[model samples]
Target chain A: MSKKINLTLKVWRQPDNRTSGRFEVYPAQDIDTDMSFLEMLDVVNDELEKEGKDPIAFDHDCREGICGMCGCVINGQAHGPDAATTVCQLHMRRFQDGMTLVIEPWRAKAFPIIKDLAVDRSAFDRVISAGGYISVRTGAAPDAHAVPVPKDSADQAMDAAACIGCGACVAACPNASAMLFVSAKVSQLALLPQGQPERDQRVVSMVSQMDSEGFGNCSNHYECEASCPKEISIKNIARMNRELTRAGVRS
Target chain B: MASSNRTLLQSSIVRKQIVAVTGLAMVGFLIAHLSGNFLIFAGPEAFNGYSKKLHDLGPILWVLRIGLIAALLGHVVLAIKLTGENHAARGGRYAVSNSRGDGGFCKKTMIYTGILILVFVALHLYDFTYRDKTGDPTIVEGVNGGLSLGLFGLVWNSFLQPWHSGLYILAMIILGFHLSHGIQSLFQSIGFFHDRYTPMVKKIGFALAILLAVGFISIPIYVNVVRTPHL
Candidate 1:
């Protein structure tokens, strides 16, 4: 038989960003240890649906954690108590029987709460739209060796490229700074040859857009790196700084 | 396509760089100031001589003062602006917000300690420079027949009162708190630090902060405990 546990959840619920929110406690009974965290929430939500109460609204897609869609502060952690694991990937076994979890949406001015445990992350989309893409022409597939990247640069770029755009960095920051996320996007391209033509313009535009979207500046608290599911390095922020500084000086 | 009219000042990162550079300038000033204060341990003659040399610089002294004031203004103004931006970034507070490592004390209370340091600087100038200019005979005395505060006498007399010494000591501690975080942050802000050397950098910052606090506090302690009032 599957090991089952009963838990209490203190979940934040609000109709919109303008309205005040409060914690709504729900009893989660007979939760299977093999189920993922989101699965356990699903069970509670199912019960709420049956009772004719407003079903708890949360964000989740590609429950395996790749989509960057599912996230919430589980017991003050951006993605629950597991390191480098998203909330959707966190299994029920991590929690013991009778434990209570406090769940809340990402609380940043850039990320307004849409409903219970769901925030409007369109601000991220705006930041990305500002400069996250390479402006190159479409052509036939070139040889893989045609544009050979240095091994170290490739690895570093890949490391930064792993960022899932989860907004966890912003959520985890004390100042709600989007530096880690923005830097990841900037570093991923800035390290590559394909991203060179517009590198200077990209960094400046993206960073300015980030400020326009109302994210705070990085103070090197390292909390964003700590909470990132991808383990994105705060060094990426340094790279972004170097890029921005050089671009500023040159122009 | 679109006319993007963004100046360097409009960029948040650049503003931070300005803050970092100016902050480090102030740190440099603190180190020099602390070294000068250390001359007091060599006795009043050495201390007064050091003060006399500084006072003799005349117009150059005004240049240094203006430069320091400009740095202070840049640090304080940007700090205030960045703080507002930081506050606005958080839509609201979490009910059960918790953090680990750098998120604690020094990182969190930067603005508070910074404001305290500003207050301390104001009081410090008033106690040492302004008082001397006003010809307040109680706070000034001659050294070797020269009609000046003798720097050493000014420091010693002010620290003679327990309350004055207490406040000065407290301010040094606060300055230490500010520096511990400020030093490393300035490095990171200017892109000179990384995680590989982060532990070492943090230790350096901590050591420097402790040194400043202990170094500055030693003066008041020495004045109260060891030095005899001589004019």
Candidate 2:
């Protein structure tokens, strides 16, 4: 049995990138406790459609916390207040019945608002396109034991590879830094055997791209780790620094 | 090749490394200064003797002074540049902002505390090094019967004023706040991190900060409240 609750929603509404945004209040009556946060928004959007009002625009895909599409700052926390959870996975049971939820888009110079809650995240794509790939040829599936990767290295690489590129780290940082994201990408590839050939070039290119994108430098606040949906560690940042140093020395 | 190296130096992380290195060098200078200042407890003869020795070094002391000034300028200039870029990165402010409370008050207000300390340093140099506001003409006997300025007497007279002691104590407290975060942050900035040792580094940094603050503050308290001018 699920309990029904009424709530007041204060959502940021911007028509386009050219217009400034403002918060608009909407009454969400009889929201189910079992409903996901995005589902609650869907209910509100349906009501707005029936009343001939424009639906609140937000980005979502997969709705299973892996797509890295759904995100918004809820009550001053990115992806709501849950640890290791995305906006699509956040349940309404976490909130009080009459609580007023304040939602806003990701605020960063590199991530401009496209509509209401959807900011352009192509800056991350641009960073990836810079050097985030290994350039080895793949003819067929090779033997798993050919490379003989250490278990510890393999596990650490997997940990770094868990980044979903959600841009929540940027939103949560006081300086809007993307170091955690870029470091994770750099570390994941740097730890593997196949990543050895282009290690120096990859780190240098990705870091330069990240810097040019107007992302702030990391001041070691650890806020990004706290707000991360995948529970990424800041140790990756230290590793990235070491990798940068190694690249500098080798080049 | 030179141009490419220059580009690497201009990168955000490398610039931060420079800031960290220079900041750590200042920390070393502070420890040396505090140790020398502790000689004040040994009475006027010992304190003035120490000051004379420093003055006797002549050109070497000037070199050290110039090096320290260069370090301070590098730390301030690069820090301001990074802070401006950081401000611009956040395109706008949040209506309802909340911190995750990662490093607390000390970590967030580095720039503000640093500026206050800079102001205090300027006034300190003016009062003690350049200008003699206190009209004490006491001269201490030096090696080879040479006479040196009684730095001990001047320090004591300046500290006797409540306003001067109060300002000195306040500046020390601000320096403590700056070092509490700065000590641990410098290690991380220079690519040093560990699961077990990093926590130890933080605790050591905090203990060092508290020690330095209390050590500096004790001098003024001793001069103003404990020791009489005649004694």
Candidate 3:
């Protein structure tokens, strides 16, 4: 058995990219506490549809906290007030009856609002395309033990690999700097033997792309780490800085 | 392909490296400056002799002065450029946000303190170097049978005024705030930080910042309280 609760939502309502947006309040009546946050939104949208009003638009896929599709600023926090959890995984029970939730899209130059809460995250994809892959042939898979990577390096690579590219970091950052995201990509590759072939070129290209994308500089605020669903450590940023210095000197 | 101009000019991360290195160089200069300033505690003769030695170093002194000036200029120019880009990147501000703990006070106020320190540096140079050059007869007096403005007497007289000493103390406090973040940030920017060592590095940075601030502040206070008014 689950408890029922009523709440109010101050959600951002934007029709398109060219026009300005504002917060519109909605009454969320008789919501189940056991329901997931997205399920709660589904109920609200259905109510708006029966009345012939425009439904609130948001982005989400694989609501299990992976795939990195879901993102929004819930009450000024990226992905709501939960720690190390995505917006989709957030449950309605986290809130109390009559609580007003202020929701808005991620406000960054690189991430423009597409609708109400969905922003275009293609800028992140562009950054990845710049140098986020290795140059190895795909003819056959190598033996699992052939590389013999050090255990410490393997663990660090895995840690860096945890980033889901959800853009929460950009949303949380005051400067909108992508140091955490870019550093995660650079660190994962820099720690492996396969990623070494293009290590210098990768860092140089990726960092250049990140800058051209109009992201801010990291002043070591550590906000990205706190808001990150993956909890990616900022140490990766230091590593990327080292790699860039090495690449700059070598080139 | 050779390193493009973008790597040095437009690259925000690379610009950080530039700022970090130049900032560290300035820190080195501060340490040397504080050491020389301690010479004033050895009484007027020792301080005047050290000043004369520096004055006699001629061409070497010019080289050092030019080097310091270039470093300061590079640090300031890159800081302005990077800060502008960061401001533009934010695009818009959040309606409701909180940065209680994660956003450290020193980290956010780097620009403010940095600008303040720059203003202080300009005023300080004018007060000491320019005033010395113009030879203000009252502040600059003869010592050790020589007709030159003794550096010790000039420094002593400047601190005799309450406003001058107060401003110097305030500027040092601001410098402490700037350096508290700066020294630790230098290690990260240069890629020299480690998870195990970084904590200790931060502690050292904090301690060094306080030490430098107190060291500099003591001079004005000592001159005001202990030394007799020879000016």
Candidate 4:
């Protein structure tokens, strides 16, 4: 069997947000079909470097799909063409030889272009800073089961915990809203006994943060979940709403 | 940025419930209003009389509008909040790519339709309530005791216009798309997915959204296509 194939790649290039960006096509030949998509890009980047041209810049952390950093729209789809996986895990086998790929950064009003393919995702950090954490103080070691929440509740909370803090929800959303991420964080803690102290304040702080981030509002489109690598259910949204409504802000 | 363990947040059932309850309520309002407006088919007096009746109980109408506004705000806000959290939780980038909601047809995009409907709502209110800003929107049935078309002729005349009727039909089509996804998803949101009832609820949702959308659209389509030529 042939071990390598030729391909065409269109990558977005920009020096930084202050400058304009455009697509640059690169020819990839004799590339390992078994290589991951990022690896293929590395091969392309290496070739570009040999020619003294600057390589394309994109974001990646773990490359294991756990860190939730690697992402790009391949052919107009968020995260390439795979379901339930991050872009780092995507392999080149999915594409046929000679396929022309168009890659771009996450397009949203809230997510600005930082450079090349890398986008400014600090807005996410701000949203998290708003209210994504528990206010509990550090203490000596406690029993793992010290907080005995109901088994079902614990399980559901675990599901919310599955959220890897990926911004795919925002990318998938037309409004670029991050309600799912906020709700998941809110739900995960609120479900357990440890989350009680902050329950009243969680919803308000988190929601306010989301709005301040300039992210668009969700219109109840389930696209976030369908494209969500974690498959996080939209149910978290309702739970957050109920909590916010019940807790009703102080002001 | 709440904790990851919001137990209720994980329940798809809760999401469905919220979507269904809110969507159905809004649909109910649309139907009732449409029925009242249909009286305009009787001519200007009927429409104006209906408007007067609604205005007579000023507080009641105000309450209704307030409730409706609350519902709309709540619905949109929750949706936005969830979308934000989801984005943050997932980091807004997938390692793998799959376009779940992207299809070759408009029927697949509830979000798109929802946005369109939102714009339509703004236009709709402007055409009716704030018509004063646009110079009275051409009073349709002005006559004894009323300087305006009297609510009936105003509504009927709205349907009679080619542009207005076109916009109405287009908006309704998008509204239908939004309803089909929203109603069933609401059931899922609130955790109403029993094997015995999930299918039934879905069918019910499908029927209702399509029916309301078709019926409401038909009124304008009929007024424009069939009634206008005859007159």
Chain A TM-score per model, please list them.
0.98, 0.99, 0.98, 0.94
All candidates' lDDT scores? 0.87, 0.88, 0.86, 0.71
**Residue range A147-222, candidate 1, lDDT tens digits:** 9899989999999999999999999998899999999999999999999988888888889888888999887789
In candidate 1 chain B, what residue range of length 10 has the lowest lDDT sum?
B133-142
Q: Which residue pairs in candidate 3 collide?
A: none
Q: Report each candidate's C-alpha RMSD, comma-separated, in the order given.
A: 2.3, 3.1, 2.8, 7.5
Q: Candidate 3: TM of chain A?
A: 0.98
Clashing pairs in 1: A109-B91
Per-residue lDDT for A212 in model 1?
Answer: 86
* Candidate 1 wrongly placed segments (more than 4 Å): B1-3, B133-149, B195-198, B229-231
Over A1-251, each residue of candidate 2 has an lDDT whose tens digit, in order, gives 68999999999999988999899999999999999999999999999999999999999999999999999999999999899999999999999899999999999999999998999999999888888898867799799898889999999999999999999999999899999999999999999999899888888888888899999988888899999999898889888888888888988
lDDT per residue for candidate 4 within A1-251, as digits (tens), equals 43787899888887987777777889998888788888888999899999999988888889898887778778867677788878888888888888888887886657788877778888778766867777666989798887678998998899998988767777777557777888888889889888888786776767666666667655566677777788787778767766765664332
* Candidate 2 chain A lowest-lDDT run of ten: A129-138
- Winner of 1 and 4 under TM-score: 1
Q: Give model 1's TM-score versus the native structure.
A: 0.95
**A205-248 in candidate 3: lDDT tens per residue?**
88888888888998778789899999998899999998998887
- How much is B74 displaced in model 3, in angstroms? 0.9
Question: For all the predictions, what are the DockQ values?
Answer: 0.59, 0.49, 0.52, 0.15
Worst 10 residues of 3 chain B by lDDT: B133-142
lDDT of 2 at A27: 97
- Give the lowest summed-lDDT range of ten residues in model 1 chain A: A135-144
Error of 1 at B173 (Å): 0.6
Arranged by DockQ, best first: 1, 3, 2, 4
Q: Each model's interface RMSD (Å)? A: 1.8, 3.3, 2.6, 8.4
Docking class of 4: incorrect
